[model samples]
Target: MRRSGVVRGWRLVALVAAALAIAVVGVLAARAVLDAPALRDFFSRYPGTTERPEAAPYGFPAWLQWQHFLNAFLLVFIVKSGLQIRAKQRPPAFVTRRNTGLITTKRPPRRLGLHVWWHLVVDTLWVLNGVIYFVLLFASGQWLRLVPLTWDVIPNAISAGIQYAAFQWPLHDGWVHYNALQQLFYAATVFLAGPLALVTGLRLSPIFTQRDSWFTRRFTETAARRLHWAIMVYFLAFTVVHVTLVVTTGALRNLNAMYAGRHDESWIGLAIFAVSLVVMVLGWFVARPALLTRLAERGNDVRRMK
Candidate 1:
C-alpha cells in the first residue's frame, strides 16, 4: 500500500506537468494565429513607436541592448531572491517526495528575513520579464537562438554530462560548435519556464480561487511552491554550469557577453561570446585525469596484445 501511494504521487506530478505544457502550447498557438511576420514583428513595432535610431547591421539593436541589460539585471536579482526563499537549501519546502516509512526528509530553517516579501517582488518582475521577452523573441526572428535548433545539441549535452561526472571527453573538440549543455539548458528554459510561471500564477491567484478554477482544485499555493521547486532544478543546474565556465574561461570575457556584450570595445559582446564558446571545446584540457585514464586504458590493451 505504501508503494502504491508513491506511484500515485509520481503519476500526479506527471499529469500536472503534462497539463501545464499543453496549456502553454495552446496559448502560444492561439497568439500566433495572428501570424504577423513573426515574433520579431511584435518588437519591430516598438522601434517606430520610440524616437530611437534604427539598428545597425549585425549590431545590437537599441531595444535588444536594453533587453539584454534588463535580462542580466533581473537574472542577478532573481538569484538573490531565490536564495532568500530558501538559500542554498532544498527539501520539503522545495519539492514533494515519496516516503513509505514514518521517516521523511525535512528542510532546515533559513530564516532570511524579508524573504517572504522579496519572493513576491522578484517573481512579479520575472513574470513581467517573461511576457515582454516572449513578445520580443517572437518579433525579432530570434526564436532559433533560444530553441534547440540543431540535432547535435542532445549529443553535446550527453558529452558534457560525461565530462561533468567522470571528466571524460567522448568526442573531439571540433565535433560540436555550441556547448551541448548550454543549448539544451536554454531550450528548456524557454519551453519549461514559460509554462511554469503561468500555472504557478494561476495556482496562487486570488481571482482564480474565488472562481473555483482548475488551479485551485488541483493544487494549493504550498503544493504549487513544491512544483516550482522541482522546476528549479533546471535553474540550479544552469547556474553551476554557468559559473564554472565563467571562471574557467576568463571572467572578463564572459562578463563581456553578459555586460557590454563583448570582451573589448570591438563588435560589442560578440567576440567574448565566441571565445567563451571555444573554451568549452577545450574543457578536456582542464580535466587531465580523464584524459590520462583513456590513454592508460589504450596502453593496457596494446600491452595485452603484445
Candidate 2:
C-alpha cells in the first residue's frame, strides 16, 4: 500500500510538471507572435495604461501602507484557519456562545468547532478592515487608481496581459497610476471577488445556512461551499502572480511604494516587508489548536470534544 501511494504521488507530480512545461512552450510561442511588426505597432499604440484623468492623485499614502500590511496579516490567518476548518474531521474543541455578555442578541451563539470559530473571527476582522479600506479608498480619492472610468481600459488591459505573457513587463510608475491591467485586476479583486467570497462564506455559515429563508433557498450551501473554495484559490493565484511581478519588475521601488509609502529605492521598504513576512510566518506557526482553544475560551464556552 505504501509503495502504491508513493508511485501515485510520483505520477501526479510528473503530470503536473508536464502540464507546466506545455504551458511554458505555449506562452513562448505566443510571445514570438507578439513580436511581429503589426503586433509591435499595436502594442506601441497601447503601451498598457490609458490616459489618467487630470484630477487623479499620485503617490501611495501612509493610510494605504498601513491598510496593506493589515490586509496581508489578516489574509494569512484567514486562509490558514479556513483550510483547517475544511479538513478537520474531529475538532479538538467546540465553542458555544456566552449567555452573560453585555451585548443583547436575539439568536443564541451557535456552537462552532475551534477552527471554525477562529475562521469566523478572522473573517469578521477582515470584513471590517475591508470596509475601512473602501471608505478610505474613495474618501482619499485613491479609487481613481483602481476604478476603470474609460472604455479604453479593455484594450489596454489586453495589451498589458500580452506584455505580461510575453515576459516584457513594463516597470511602470504604479505610485502615480496603475496600468489598465492592474487597475482592472485591483477593481475586480476588491469589488467583485472580495464581495463574492464574503457572500458565499456567509451563505455557508451557520447563521445563514441554519435559516430557511429566501437566501438559503436561492443559494444552496453546497454551491456556496464550492464557490468559497474557488474564491480562495483565486486569491492564492492572484497573490503568487502579484508578488512575482512586484519582485521582477522593480523589487525595491515596488516594495517602497507598498510598505514605506515612498517612491525611492530605499532599504526601509524591504526591511518592513521582511518584518511583516516574519510576523505572518510566526502567526501561522502559532495558530495551533492549543493556542486557539485558549483564545476561543475567553469569549465563548469551549468544551473538549475528544
Candidate 3:
C-alpha cells in the first residue's frame, strides 16, 4: 500500500533515532570493555601530520565554494527524484519513437515519467558540475588534499574512524589539513562513487536497453538497478555522517571555510549556509512533478523541433 507522507516521515525519524541509540550503546559498551590507553593506542596506529607539502595554500577558494554549492544543490534534487522514481507503484507511462518504432518505459512504472525526466535532467547537470569540479580541483592542485599520497593513510583512517566512534573527535582543520578519514571519504565520493553512479545510471537508461551489445549483456539492468540503489544509499549515509561530523566537530569553522572561504571563527559562514539551505528547501517544494512534467514536455518539444 502507498504510505502517506506524514507516516513515511515519522517512520524515517523513528528509524534514525533507533540507529543513533544503538550506535551510542555500542560505543559505550566498547569503551567499558576496553582500557582507555589500549583503545587510544589501537585507534592511533597511523599518525596524521599537519606538515605536508601537499597541504599548501590553505582555505577554500571562490571556485570551490561555488562548486560545493552546486554539488549540494544538484545532489539534493537527484536523490529526491531518484527516490520518487524507485518508489513509484503504478505502471510507467510510455513514449514511442515514431522512426524506430521503439517503446521505452519497460522498467520504471508508468506514472514515473516526470520523476525520471527530472532525475535525468539533474543527473546531467550533476555530471557537468562534476566535470568542472574535477578540472578545477586538479588544475588548482587541490586534488592533493583529497588523494592519499602515502600508504599510512589506511591506518590513519582507521584510527580516525575509531576516534569518531568513541566520541573522542579527531583534530579537524579542513582549512589546513583533513584527517585521513576525511581524505579517504572525499576521494571515494569524487573518484569512485561519482563514476560508479554515472555508469550504473547509464546502464538503466533506455538507450542502453535498446542496444543489445556485450556491455549491456555483462552489466544487466537488474545489476545496474541494484548498484544504483546501493549508490544512492551510500550517498544518503555519507551525507548524514558528514553533516553530523561538521556540526559536532566544529560548525563555525567548517561553515566558514566552506561558505565564506575564510578560516576565521564567525557567524558569517553560518548565515550564508542558512540562506543556501533556505534556497534548497524552496527548490524541494518548487520541483514538483506537475511542474517538472511541463518543463520536460517543453524540452521534448524543443528537441523534436530541432
Instruction: Please report how far candidate 3 places residue 304 from its true position, in Å.
Output: 17
What candidate 3 gets wrong by more than 4 Å, as runs, is 1-25, 29-45, 48-51, 89-112, 302-306
Model 1 lowest lDDT segment of ten: 47-56
Better-scoring candidate (TM-score), 1 or 2: 2
Instruction: State which candidate, 1 or 3, has the greater TM-score.
Output: 3
Model 2: residues >4 Å from true position, as ranges? 1-17
Order the candidates by lDDT, highest first. 2, 3, 1
lDDT of 2 by residue, 85-162 (tens): 789678899998786759546887788888888998999999998999999999988998889999988888888887
TM-score, per-candidate, Cα-based: 0.47, 0.93, 0.81
The Cα local distance difference test for each model comes to 0.49, 0.88, 0.78
What would the per-residue lDDT of candidate 1 be over residues 1-306, giving only the tens digit for each residue? 999999999999999999999867765654453344663443233211112123312223446546655554555545554555556332112211233345343542222223333344456776777778778776875554445554655554554553444333223221112355655666576668657855865564433444565647777777877776666666667668766765554455445545453434344455544554455435323423233234334312211111
Q: What's the count of clashing pairs in each model shown?
A: 10, 0, 5
For candidate 2, the per-residue lDDT at 270 reads: 92
> Residue-wise lDDT of candidate 3 within 134-244, one digit each (tens)?
999999888887888888788777767666766777777898888889998999999999999999999987668668999999999999999999999998899999988
> Worst ten-residue run, lDDT, model 3?
91-100
Error of 2 at 10 (Å): 7.3
